[model samples]
Target chain A: MLKIDNLHATAGDKEILKGISLTVNAGEVHAIMGPNGSGKSTLAQIIAGHPGYVVTAGSVTYEGKDLLAMPAEERAQAGVFLAFQYPVEIPGVTNAYFFRSAYNEVRKANGKEELDPIEFLDLMEKKLKLVEMDEAMLHRSVNAGFSGGEKKRNEILQMAVLEPKLAILDETDSGLDIDALRVVAGGVNALRRPDNATIVVTHYQRLLNYIVPDFVHVLAHGRIVKSGGKELALELEARGYDWVMEAA
Target chain B: MATATNATGEAYEQAFGALRAQGGPSWLPALRREAMDRFSALGFPTTRNEDWHFTSVTPIAERVFKVAPTRSGPATLSPADVAALVISDPDWHRLVFVNGRFEASLSAFAGLPADVRVTTLADALKESPEFVAEHLGKLASGEGQTFTAFNTAFAQDGVVIHVPGGEIVEAPVHIVHIADAQAAGAGIHPRLLVVAEALSRLTIIESFASTGSFGAPYLTNAVAEIEVGNGARVDHYKIQRESTDAFHVGTTQVRQGRDSMYHSFSYAAGAAISRTNVYTQLAGENGETRLNGLYLIDGTQHADHQTFVEHLAPGCASRELYKGILDGSSHGVFNGKVYVDPVAQKTDGKQTNHALLLSEHARVDTKPQLEIFADDVKCTHGATVGRLDEDALFYMKSRGLGAENARALLTYAFAAEVLETIEVDALREGLEALAFARFTQSFGEQR
Candidate 1:
């Protein structure tokens, strides 16, 4: 479903993603694990078309189309989603309003009829149960004064509402407690379909236990150095990343 | 330049003389004479004045505007035309003024209580002379204000509202001031006097608008004085949406008695140059006052708001919030000051001003001043000027909103922070629709 060939990118004057290549097929869950400052989040943001990063030399093909040539919003309309590490606080925009606008935009782009507020609210109630979030949160400002776990859960709620084909979970498990992690992982697992895919980026192996991945890749110094089965995550968690770095 | 200024001053003097020649009322001639003298002495404020540093009234000073005729004449506006220019609601007690003259045919106050009195200032002078004499030109004096003096000297007609003690007014009083094409190249001064007696409650909406795309240059100098008696509550809303080629200067003075409450909201969205000043005095213990304002302008427009609150008694509180949205080289200014006297202890005051610039050339100036002579008081003030948050914009765009849609949404949200506080439903909805349409249209033009 996605292909990245020798992705060389930089933010400002410093190179972040050196030389990296990865491929993922349909219905497969991939986990990219690394230590701090290993470009795990950068790789996820680049795939979502964050404008801060400069892709000097690389090619990212999504469903046989060059993805790097599209703007961030266009990429979003084309079924790309990024669950932010730190969700933004829009002071006066309600979560329900934001979700409705986003859902209608994606629908319009895909040549589908837009849903009215009543229709959208009916669909939103079902998604709210998946994340175990209170309906009151939808009326409040988006992410303003929300708890860390609530923000992470809100991200998942958006992902469920949009139903993007390619979802990149960038450090989604950073600030969540154990209970929140279970609920979030459960929500993601429920949305897994035969034609869609997910790339979970994380620094620890705890999140993988709930939403088990089919393939595990260790990213060190902006390069994928090790690839193995689900057992590889347990091996790296037990031994640490230094061995993999030395081998690379 | 001196000759031009003299010419403008002489023109006003001639108009004042013309008004006096046809005036009634035994006690009005002296008041008008004194005010005219004060206006001549004060003249138009220059940029050198500290209060007028950020704003220049050169455009208003250079022009010589005649007094608009009292009658509508050939530019006769119908009831439907008047309804379309204001927040039309059948339940509201309304008074319509055209070119500073009361249009009784267009006004309605059918079922008001016997004790409550709502009429024109000109009629009140004849009906209840002593009551009109007690409050008129008292709180909003022409001592140090040039525009207030100008209004006092030239105001031919306006609205006068009086609520007796302990009477709760059910419907709001809506005062509509319209300037038609006949008012082109002329000046009109409209006055408002509201008196809420002890334990009474009232709401007043004063709106200024132009008639049907009237684009000629005119001047609207308006003044309002509100008296909140002991334990009384009053909510005053002033909305200014003049023609884009016109100029507006308005002043609102408020006095609160023991345990009284006063709330003032100013909304400015039109006019080439506009200035609004709100001043309040807490005269008795445990009084509360709130001053809130919002201004949205674009296309070389200039808008300014100046507010002052004085704490004279112990246990008084005041709060202020002003927000502005400027685009297309527009300029906005906010100057707010709070004073706590030596006798006023345990006073609580807070002030905040924020401005959002939508274009690269848009500008804003905010100044917050606090003068405290009391030992036990809590006061704080803050000001912020910034563009839209880039991260928030990106976050919205990532959720599938296009760049233009994201910017417009964020800009409207910034304005919604203040619009949400309006207690009146019809007025709030009207302003919200206007703001939404404005931002969307401007952003669409940019694209």
Candidate 2:
């Protein structure tokens, strides 16, 4: 469902994603593991179409459609979702109102009818139960005064509502506790289907324990140095990315 | 700094001249003449005036505003028109006006509480000349103020609300003022007099808005006198969302009796330049007072709030909080002061003003002052000027909200605190819609 070939990106004069490439098909979860400054997160951001980081070379296509040509919002409507490491807080805007607007935008993009208040509420009720999140969260401002874990849960809550085709979890496991991780992972696993995909970007191998990935790639120095099956994450955790960096 | 002065100055002189014919009790014309003499004596305020510091109204002073809609003041509001500003509570009564003039033909005053009474200023003047003579320009008025003198001289028709003694109104009351800008250079000077008798209760909302694309640079200068009698309670809200090019200057002077409670909540979002002044005097011991304001400005809009609270009697309490969010090149100012007399002991007062600058070009100037002569009193005052928390902004973005959307939401939330302070549901809802639209436009959609 997603393909990136020799991604070359930079922040100003400094290069971040030098020449990294990866591909993920439907129903498959791919984990990109790397150390600090290894450009793993940059690859995820560039793919999400964050402006600031100039994509100088390479190409990314989703379902054979040009990805880099679209704006961040359009990319989102195109089923490209990114679970940011930190969530933004919007005061006076309730979770219900925000999610409804987002859902309608995407549905409208796909030539689908917008859901009325009642219909939207019903959809959110089901997703709320799926993520084990309460309606109380929907009544409050968007992520205002929410905890780290709750924010990550909100990210998953939005993911569940939008039901994206290719989801990019950018350090999604950074702030979650043990129980939260299980809930988040369960929700993510529940959404996995043959027509959708997941790309887990993390510096640790712990998140892989709940929702195992089909392929684990060690990203060091802005390039993929090693690629293997799920066992590769455990190997990287035990030995560290120093070996991967040296090999690169 | 090249002001629109010559225009406003000429306009003020013209409006002030045409109003001299509105003779009341002979004392009133004498007062107007004196005020006019004082205004000209004062001339246009320079930076030297302490109150005018940081705010150079020279531009406002120069531009001339054509005499307001008085020529076509009384307007008809259809039921559809009322719905645009209606609050859904069937329990209360409402009196809607068009451009500061009373429109009894279109207003509904059925089944009003017995103790609650209302009359147009013109009607009240004819029915009870005693009350008009006794209270006219009684609380506060001055020729030193060009606009106040102007409003007094014109002394156009307004509303007089009196909640009789021992009557506590269960429902709210609204006075909606809509301006017709179809007439070029027309202006509106709406006035209000609210008197809550002993042990009475009242809630009033005074809103100023405009319709049509007359597109002329009109102006509105308004003043309200509120009196809360002994043991009475009053919640007053002033919502000003005039046209973007309109200039609004208003004053609210309140007098509280022993053990009375008075609250003033104001939200300013429109107008090219707007200034609202609130003055309250704790006349009797144990009186309570609160003054709050939320002014959100973007682009070239400028909003300024100046307030003063006095503790004349002992055992009184007062609180004031004003917040603003400025985007683009908009500017904001807040100057608040609390005064405690020597005999006014046991006064508990707190004042706080904060501004959140949303852009580098957006500027805010805030100052809080306290002058206490009493020995036993608790007084606190503070002012803060800054921007939205960056950490807070990034946190919103992390939740799939774009950077612009995050900023917009946070700014709206920042101003929501002031909106919540509005006790009137209809007024609050109206303000909420306006503030939401404002921030949304500035920050755009973030879905």
Candidate 3:
């Protein structure tokens, strides 16, 4: 339920996303792979409503609504989620407290009743198990001193709790170890539904093994150079992006 | 300038004479005379002085505050009124002072050990003259300090707590000072003396607040001296919440003996002009000192905090963290100095001061001074003044928090970093609620 047409974005004086077009329907998982500085993360952030980038000549539509017109917080309340590539550390705020506040804000926006501490804790316990995280992590500061693997798992935990309609995972597997990658993928896989969609943006093909994608698109120089079925991922993994770049 | 100084000094001299005529202990007159002389010589600090460069005491120096008179009958405040000003449990030992005089009717302390004395300075002087003479004015000598000299010369009644050797005071001692309507145009001086003997453990909370809706201007000058005996532990907290038109100046001096520990926290959120000075001395080896403070001010309010930690013995550690949130045209200042003596090798000291400016006109000045004589020591200091982190705000907004809510939450979290270190459960919770409420009100006003 998402569409991007001729999306051309710029960050300051440099044009990052040039003439990019993509579309995805419900119940589908799309994997966007690219090399360094290929605008993979930029596309994800623009859709999530990051204020740092300017969409110069494009329109992004989500379920027949202009996504670019909404603010970041409004986008989040409307069931659009972005798992940051590098999560921000918020000192002096407990993880559980932050999660509860965020969950209630989204619920209130959607005309749902807010959960109290006890009710939130009950839901949190189940989500914590989904990511295989210890209960103690809830008491510590939000990602203040968490390891790279723990931070990734925490992001997935949040995804499970929020249950967004459209989720974008940007470099979620960049800093994870083998076990952490498997756990994060398991959490994402468990939350999949026919009415929801996900976009996985990564530089490596290893994460595809865990959460297999229905469509594979190779991005180069801010444009999709190749699009194919699941076998394209293996082909690109075996041979580098050199062939794709030459053909494009 | 000279004539104005003389005029201010003459007014205080007359007040000192009046206080002397009231009569006190045999040795009090001479001490008061010396303090008065020192105050006259030092006068009020001007902007020319390095210590007072950022603050201007013109508002305080222009007005003359008469010494508050002693109440012959019961105070006008009710028990409920006093309870609202204090942040402590009902079961804790409490001493309530109104207009710098002890209010015995409102104060209570039962079941305390016989050796442990939690009484007023006046009573202590009459009951144990020798003990009072030994410790009083020993640590906080008003030599070059103008406000300390003024407080020592005028202070008539205050709290005196003494824990004998090896006594562990399970309950904290709460001292509540209230400036009512009568305190307007009056000078109220409150003194505190805490002596924790060897191996003793003590916790003390001092609160300065105001009552009545008069909104008249006044002055509250206070002094506190703490002596931590060998291997003793002391936790001290001071909360200042005066009227918006009042001026508050307080000094706290602490001395830690061999293997002793001292932790001091200062919270300043009121008054038109407020200054708090905390000086700690690590006199013996293996001692530790911690000084943490937080200030939240708006409007034309001005808050200043000066801290000095001296390492006189080896293997001592000192840490300081002070944070301020300024809004409107308010001004905030933080000056911290850490001294490492030649004999104090292996001294570990760190000082950090941060200020958050919520308005364009809000201002802050932070200075960290380090004097290192020992060859081998670790000392570091940092200061920062800025607005809230934009990245952090965006991150919070991305999680569905409104922009205003994100701003207010970040500001509260910045203050909570220092507030969470408080060991007293009731006091910590009370201050946290106060900070939260303050941020909510301020942010709502912005909307």
lDDT tens per residue, model 3, A69-188: 999888888888888898888887888988999999999999999999999999999999999999999998888899998888888988988998999999999988899999999999
TM-scores of all predicted structures: 0.96, 0.80, 0.98
Chain A (candidate 3) TM-score to true chain A: 0.99
lDDT of 1 at B28: 88
Q: Which 10-residue span in candidate 3 chain A carries the lowest summed lDDT? A: A84-93
- Write down the C-alpha DockQ for each prediction: 0.71, 0.17, 0.76
Q: What is the Cα-based TM-score of model 1?
A: 0.96
> For residues B410-443, what per-residue lDDT tens digits would candidate 3 score against the true structure?
8999998999989999899999999988897788
**Interface RMSD for candidate number 3?**
0.8
Locate the minimum summed-lDDT window of 10 residues in model 3 chain B.
B1-10
Candidates' chain A TM-scores: 0.99, 0.98, 0.99
Candidate 1 or 2, higher TM-score? Answer: 1
Give RMSD (Å) of candidate 1 vs. truth.
2.0
Model 2, B1-447: lDDT tens digits are 122255555566676777766655556667767766565556556657777676766555655556555434445567577556543344556677776667776567666676577877778777776776676667757535666765665657778887889987777776777776553466676777888899999888777777666566777888888899999999988878887878888888899999999999988887888989899999999999999999888889889899999999999999998999888899998999899999999999999898999789999988787899999999998888988876665444433455676567778788886787887676678678777787878667434
Tell me the tens digit of each residue's lDDT in model 1 across B75-111.
3777898778876577888888888888888889867
RMSD of 3: 1.4
DockQ of 3: 0.76
Instruction: Give DockQ: model 1.
Output: 0.71
